[model samples]
Structures are given as C-alpha cells and as structure tokens.
Target: MSPIVVPSRLKLFGLVILILFLCFPYGGAAYSPHMASVVRISQIYSGGGNASSPYGCDFVELFNSSSVAV
Candidate 1:
C-alpha cells in the first residue's frame, strides 16, 4: 500500500483554524473595556540606604479609566 500525503495548503489552513480557536477567548478577553483600564507599573529600589529615591520614592499609580473597578 502507498502512503498518503496531505496538501500543504490544507495543513496550513487547519493550523490557522486551530490557532484561532485556541486564541478566541484570549482575544475576546483583551477587548474588554476593563482591560483598557488595567495598568501595570514597575519600580526599582536601590539596596543602599544612601541611594536617592527615584521619582521621590519609587511608586506605582493605577488609573481606572472605566467606572468599574477591576
């Protein structure tokens, strides 16, 4: 018996569909207005006491653009 082979285009289309299915939820989640309000802040503090605080002491500020709290 001869081995069967699949076409590359069909394989690629299948892969794209699979990826879209897996990512659909994540993509939908990202579109939420709540996500737009979410903010990520980072600060680095020097170990030494003498080190001057950056920005008058490292801090993080989260702004809620939306009325709802996340």
Candidate 2:
C-alpha cells in the first residue's frame, strides 16, 4: 500500500471548520430573550448527605422564568 495524501484545499477547509468550531459558541446560550423553553433546572442536589446535612436527599429543582404556565 501507500501513504494517503490530502489536497491543500481540503486541508484549508478543515482548518477553517476547526477554527469556526473553536471560535464560536457551541449549543444554546444560558439566557435568551426569545427562548423556546422557559423552564430550566435552577438547582440540582444529589447524593445522600451525612451527619449535618440539609434536606438529606437528592433533589432537582426547576424554575420557570416565563410568566405563562408550562
């Protein structure tokens, strides 16, 4: 067999894609004025606590920022 060779244009395109992926933000932002899902997981508590622990249990709290009912 022989070593594979990549075209210069293809390499440049790959570099551009990598730069874009690194420079720009991935996934949705934390807060948005015009967001679809208003409900968010405000707090998360996991694992059972020890001698002086509050609540003493795991719980996931959700908060609704929007006024409309979900």
Candidate 3:
C-alpha cells in the first residue's frame, strides 16, 4: 500500500476558500438579481378648491414606463 500524500498549505487554503465560496456564494447575492423599477407615481393632488370646500381629497396615479407588467 502507498503512503497517504498530504496537500500543501497553499493548496489547502485554496480548497477552503473554494468550499466557502460555494457554500456562501457572494453574500447570497447570486440567488437574487437586482430589481429595477419601471412603475412610478405620476400625479398627486391634495388640498385643492373645487366648489366650496377648502380641503380636498388627495389623488394618486401610477404610470408604467415599461411595456411588460411589473
């Protein structure tokens, strides 16, 4: 039988780094991609005079810049 051959210190360090990288994986960023927002608030109106009331209800509108649903 042949004697067991031990890996060098540098090789061991590299192997440990590789294992850690595979286990953790860039702070888990590789699993989720960065989100890009295409939808934005277009208009808002509050405290406007309509007929007689001094304070009015607020209005909010949403606009989609992209063609795809987001």
Candidate 4:
C-alpha cells in the first residue's frame, strides 16, 4: 500500500542492468551475409577526342559494401 524508496546507487545499478539487457545483442557491430556479397565497380571511358593518347583512360575499381572499408 506504499511506494518503496530505492537508494541512488541501487537505482543506477538497476538502470545499467536494464540497459545491458536491452542492448547486449545490438551493442556491438553486426555483419550480414547479404552485405558481404555486395560489390562495386568503377570504370573509365575513353572518347574519340583522345585518340592521340597511346593508352586510353581505362580503369577499373572494386569495393565491398560492409561497414568496414576494404
């Protein structure tokens, strides 16, 4: 029939425990197989205006779509 008063330290501890319980699964970074499969490609095109160049400006680039840079 009455409210219970909890000490400040106890309250803080309870809050921390609650947060950890709610966030433990997602607190750290996660990886997805679908994202791992992603790939990026970059290409360069050459035009007739640069016919004098011995090598056309042709290049290729690749990238990964994960949170980590590769």
Between candidates 1 and 3, name the one with more favorable lDDT: 3
With a 3 Å backbone cut-off (N, CA, C), the pairs that clash in candidate 1 are: none
Question: Candidate 3 lDDT, tens digit per residue, 1-70?
Answer: 9998777997899999999999987676443232255667899776566766566666788888878776
Best by TM-score: 2
Cα lDDT of model 4 by residue, 1-70, tens digit:
8999899999999999998888886777788777657867655545434868666565566776667665
Candidate 2 local lDDT, 9-70, one digit each (tens)? 99999999888888775743466556657888998877657666676888999888988876
Worst 10 residues of 3 by lDDT: 28-37
C-alpha TM-scores of all predictions: 0.35, 0.40, 0.35, 0.33
Q: Model 3: how far is 28 from its true place, Å?
A: 14
Report the error of model 3 at residue 24, Å. Answer: 20
Q: For each predicted model, how many residue pairs clash, with residues at least 3 apart or on different chains? A: 0, 0, 0, 0
lDDT (C-alpha, whole model) for all candidates? 0.64, 0.80, 0.73, 0.72
lDDT string for model 1 (1-70, tens) is: 9988999999999999999988895666546554755654444444334456344454445555555657
Position 61, candidate 4: lDDT: 61
Per-residue error for 19 in candidate 2, Å, reads 50
| Residue 6 in model 3: lDDT | 73
Residue 31 error, candidate 2, Å: 20
Model 3: residue 57 alpha-carbon error in angstroms: 2.6
